[model samples]
Target: MTPRWTATGLSQDLPKGVVMAGHWQGHDLAVWRSATGRLQAWNDRCPHRGMRLSHGFVRGETLACIYHGWVYGAEGGCKHIPAHPALTPPATITVTAFACVEQDGVIWVAPADMAGSPPAVSGVQPLRSVSLTCDLAAVLAVEPALLGQDILRGTVQIDGQGHDVCLLVQNNPAGLTLHALCGVRANKVAASHWVENLRRRAEMKVAA
Candidate 1:
């Protein structure tokens, strides 16, 4: 099967030394950036005890599980086991990792064997992400101009001006999320308000 990249989050949102929960094609992911700025996406569950690795903390170049402080290093291999300090963790104790990359201020994830780079969105800046209680159809119903399946692109009226906007779609269990981006020269505050307004309108349509 061909590999597809899913926009998981914005690059600025997942700074170094932080971890966040992400999803891709129904699989929950623990996406993190090491202290040195290495990006990684792994199965949310720790191999040792099934603890959500998203809750784990980053220590330098490794991710340590919050449950038992088991440290996973490069390629998701278990490097250290806090309980048995002297014992070297076997390679079998490894977390499942996916292909994670940051491009055009967006974080994209796919299966580990994914090959190509993520789609590019030039001349735009990252806006805030908003979760709507409705699906993509509701969004399109509200803004008929937006087009595309994964990366919705179009111009939105902001402050009486037409501003190019991009909404990266993320399908959540609850509904969905739109990781927004606006024209680089657009008024950020006004663009943000437009995003919220779009969410309200789309969700209200769903409710109706």
Candidate 2:
């Protein structure tokens, strides 16, 4: 449902000291982790010149624009301007920031009162993520929910016994990206192969 963790990004993808453009429940998003390993998400536009902040860089705990070198903090507050180093950027120069948190190795973005906290995926290990050109209905049609279709769904073992799955499906501008996870004790080899098969099956589902 509507939660604070709004389909942010694949955990392993966004590395330290880098800024990436992403989407959160259809909203254009910019996600970046500081040198200290803190993650932040905000509207992709820069306040000064409307530069795409994803085109910016993480220079420590702040994100700096490549065009004119305006820097912002995790709270989306403008912290510096290279051209005029003497000026303390006004509070008005800050970018719109959303509440973000990472859990089960997945990134999430939403408003402050972002409904409930991120769903727990205790003891489950995320496998990999895949995007489907079709909607969730199409995805379910082929792989019908083995348990249920509710949010924070518990999936069946992709490779069977002792192997349970955790799925995070969200809609995007184009389609859907399924952030998949498996039980911590699931067979890695079988899990890997199963994900491969899932791709094939999901692809066929979307195509038809």
**The best candidate in terms of TM-score:** 1
Model 2 weakest lDDT span, ten residues long: 145-154
1-208, model 1: which lDDT tens digit per residue?
Answer: 3459999999989999999999888889999999989999999999998999999999999999999999999699999998899999887898999999999999999998888788999989999889888999999999998999889999879999999999999888988888999999899999999999999999999899
List, in order, the clash count of every candidate structure: 0, 1
lDDT score, residue 6, model 1?
A: 92
lDDT for position 206 in model 2: 69
Per-residue error for 161 in candidate 2, Å, reads: 5.0
lDDT of 2 by residue, 31-138 (tens): 899998889988999899988999988999999887899999878999888889999989888898888888778887787567777767677776777776767676
Clashes of 1: 0
The positional error of residue 146 in candidate 1, measured at the CA in angstroms, is 0.6
Candidate 1 Cα misplacement greater than 4 A, ranges: none
lDDT value, residue 177 of candidate 2: 73
After TM-score superposition, the amount by which residue 3's alpha carbon in candidate 2 deviates from its true location, in angstroms, is 5.6
TM-score of each: 0.96, 0.85
In model 2, the clashing pairs are: 6-109
